[model samples]
Target chain A: MAENTAYDRVKAARANNRPTGKDYINALVDNFLELHGDRRFGDDPAIVGGVGWLGGVAVTVIAIEKGRGAKDRLTRNFGAPNPEGYRKALRLMKQAEKFRRPVVCFVDTSGAYCGIEAEERGQGQAIAENLMEMMTLRTPIISVLVGEGGSGGALALAVADEVWMLENSIYSVISPEGCASILWKDSGKAADAAQSLKLTAQDALDMGIIERVLPEKEMGKEGFYSVLRAELCAKIEELEILPLPELTEMRYRRFRALGAQQLAGE
Target chain B: MPFIDFFNFQPKNELEKGGRQSAPIAQDDNEPAKTCPNCHRQIPLSQLWGNDHCCTNCDYHFRMNSRQRVSFMTDSGSFTELYAGLCADDFLRFPGYPKKLETTRNASRETEAVICGTAKIDGRECCLFVMEPYFMMGSMGVAVGEKITRIFEYAAENSLPVVGCTVSGGARMQEGMLSLMQMAKVSGAVKRHSDAGLLYITLITDPTTGGVTASFAMEGDIILAEPGATIGFAGARVIEQTTRKKLPQGFQTSEFLLSHGFVDAIVPRAQQRKTIGSLLKLHSGGAENG
Candidate 1:
């Protein structure tokens, strides 16, 4: 492989694990400790959950994992979490409520893990349980999509107090290839389907599907950590003053508004 | 005893020299006759059932149960049902809803219209779901949505191809908005499954209508429909009444849908299994390499 090829370029860029979001949050906050495992079964590497600091306020963080290479991708299940991963996230979400800490999630995945083992392990029940549990989670939670945010894997995290996605990110129910195959019987028309499906950040914002869009220019891996850290700190500072009841109401209303289409009568 | 004497009935040609006394009964011309729905010929119930749910003369189509459909579409003994026990309760007190439920339950021996399961079609393992019109007129309700959602979720988790044999009158009227909510629920579930890069094919059957037609039924990765199947959203009468015009011939038929890009293929009943199996194999094979 050439040293300066596109793959190498992308690989080098991703090597900086301390993105702006993670770094700034770490430095500005204190006493951050991470948690793992679903307890019902095994732990999921795709979604990492734990108690972390934002300034002086404690918060729960759930992030979608992205492996650095093909081998790592296999290990991370290509960022698609199995049932145990969702279960682990569910466990942490409950803990966040117990300790009265706000939850923040970073979403970046193609979708949930699709494999024989995952189904045999009751994937449907797992996702259903997560949705049911999250619907009733008492703590205020926020989510941000740093990269590709495809379907329920993203929805698992995106259903929060506030949802944000970086510019250039895509959030869709299905990928263009899948849509094209269903509609045209030809996967080559994926580009056209992508245009029609309206899976971009701006399209989502226009449809009132999400709250905000984070600019991608200063959102590189290294820069993303700091920027996210700063944003989280500011958000936490703003949220700390609100009463629990208000936070609870806001969280409830936030999810209730998704996919609300314009009524014909209206 | 002769066949004519078995039913205590006389054969019309019993005395004819060349006519066999025990021959099958010949219809009497100008006599009180039950006209066949397809050919307008007088036929008995025994003949209709003996013809295997088809018009004896004109081959008119007949609605089938999910079990019958799966058998027709998959290899024998291949159906492994998913969410078999998900039944709807009378959550809302709609008038006569309980009676209607009881009637359909007794008639169809099923709790809901749709049955979701994994089956082998022409030797290819596939996750398939079939909707039978006998149960509650195949109306989509909470149970239908839950069952379908479970199917898609299972398909996505297993990296298996998903197939749906869709037939419905519309959303369940008793459930009202709850029924409407199922449109979103199933659509969302199908979307998630599709995003996982799994094959999701939909086979539209006769009388696919209303909210069912608007959502996941139309959102297939590859759509197919049975020949001559009626596939549309608005009822034929309602559309005609609203337009104040005569609709074109063959409107909303599977052939029409194929022409309008709503369906990929118009498959015959006997060939549906082979067609779907080939498509599944091709799609799954492609996925295996990647």
Candidate 2:
């Protein structure tokens, strides 16, 4: 049976057994050291950021974590980040740039947390600062979409040299239910909205929104982590070799060209 | 059978010597009397327009189209529009997008949600972009992003100061991830403009939230907001639903932002030109003296 509908993939991405950000971090990174607090505010459990060794190469790792089970997910705010989470990620990213270490990010969230406290703490400004700084971070950076890559929240960590997505993952400006309700005034039409969103990893790759679609055949097994680890190491090493100007310039150009079809033809 | 009157076009009370402000009787829709949402006073449209689209009664600021904003913000006959008439495609062929664009184009008379160009404000030249509220609430789709990015790049190359006004419902969802990419793209442009040592000022208008806020709107060197404008990282309704707490009065208003130190100043519509002009004069690098 062919099981390749967009809605199917969306559900699969949110499956209970799917590996979360911590799973990837625990598997791929060695000598992991956890860092906390955004310096300006309290620490957010939704985002985990610190230095770690990836194939013996020191790098700063940040992941938006959706903890497994009810209690854990509640503790992590279901992986939706607060302003402090993004700030913490930015702090680590800046530190990574200073030490000439590569920055790796694992993004999986429904979106940034929408709350009175988040708004009061300046979620927009926090994300905006990350976007501006990450654009020219002066270091090799890679972002992998392990699950849902929700709008600006995910994007705060994803203005990278290369953004990759797992096969069943989805990245969208808004969730299908939200989009359906807003556009058609019918949340029941989410499947149709999902089809229209072009949110699948393959769609993202086709649109040049992302660089790669990581296959999910052996996803939860030991072989999956080893393969991903090898690929990440090789890719980051290649990216690290580029001169700083070229590296940042390339990163800028990558995002600059996404919706910029007008420039080429004109 | 009694004859029935089908149409009723009469006011509640016939004409008489009116109250304190019988200043001008509006005859029809063209010269209609608009009621202020704040003061609940009936004021003529012309009087409101004359007062910079703010309520003459309670000073409630009304939303202005890009052209009206540009006309008032710039010197007379100084704006030269750039990146005009760029086509917007239903790139992903999202449901109803093509038809929505068609209706929106017909209604708003703007090809895009933003109008960008170079303008002279108070005798000082700068690159300017004003978001048009009539079009999709000035949503930043591909075209809006392209125009904004071009303006910033142009300003950087010309060594011109940039002034922009932003109002949006965030990234346009019809365009999907492509719409979201604009945030990063425009921020890159802003970064380059900042790196060039030129000033970029953003005048945030009513309801500047979502993707716009998280990107170029907040990236301005000097950020200003209109009085009574709602400025926030998240939508108030969304926050209320998420937090399930009663939001405090004046929670995300311009005054709140000013108090919170997120905004540099809460400039009223009447004082915006003078304040911006003074800032520009200060940052003009002795050009005025020369």
**CA lDDT of each prediction against the hidden true structure:** 0.68, 0.91
lDDT of 1 by residue, B54-119 (tens): 556776666667887887778889899878877776654544567888999898998788999999
Top of the candidates by TM-score: 2
- All DockQ scores: 0.02, 0.53
Clashing pairs in 2: none
For candidate 2, lDDT tens digit of each residue in B1-290?
23453343434443433434444554565668888878898888888899999998789999999999999999999999988876568888888988998999899998889999999999899999999889999888988888899999999999999999999989999889899999999999999999889999999999899999999989999999999988887888878877899999999888988887789988899999988988889899886664
- List runs of model 2 lying over 4 Å from the truth: A1-3, A262-266, B1-30, B287-290
- For model 2 chain B, where is the 10-residue window of minimal lDDT? B1-10
Docking class of 2: medium
Chain A TM-scores, candidates in order: 0.84, 0.97
Pick out the ten consecutive residues of candidate 1 chain A with the lowest summed lDDT: A257-266
lDDT of 2 at B35: 82
DockQ, candidate 1, comes to 0.02
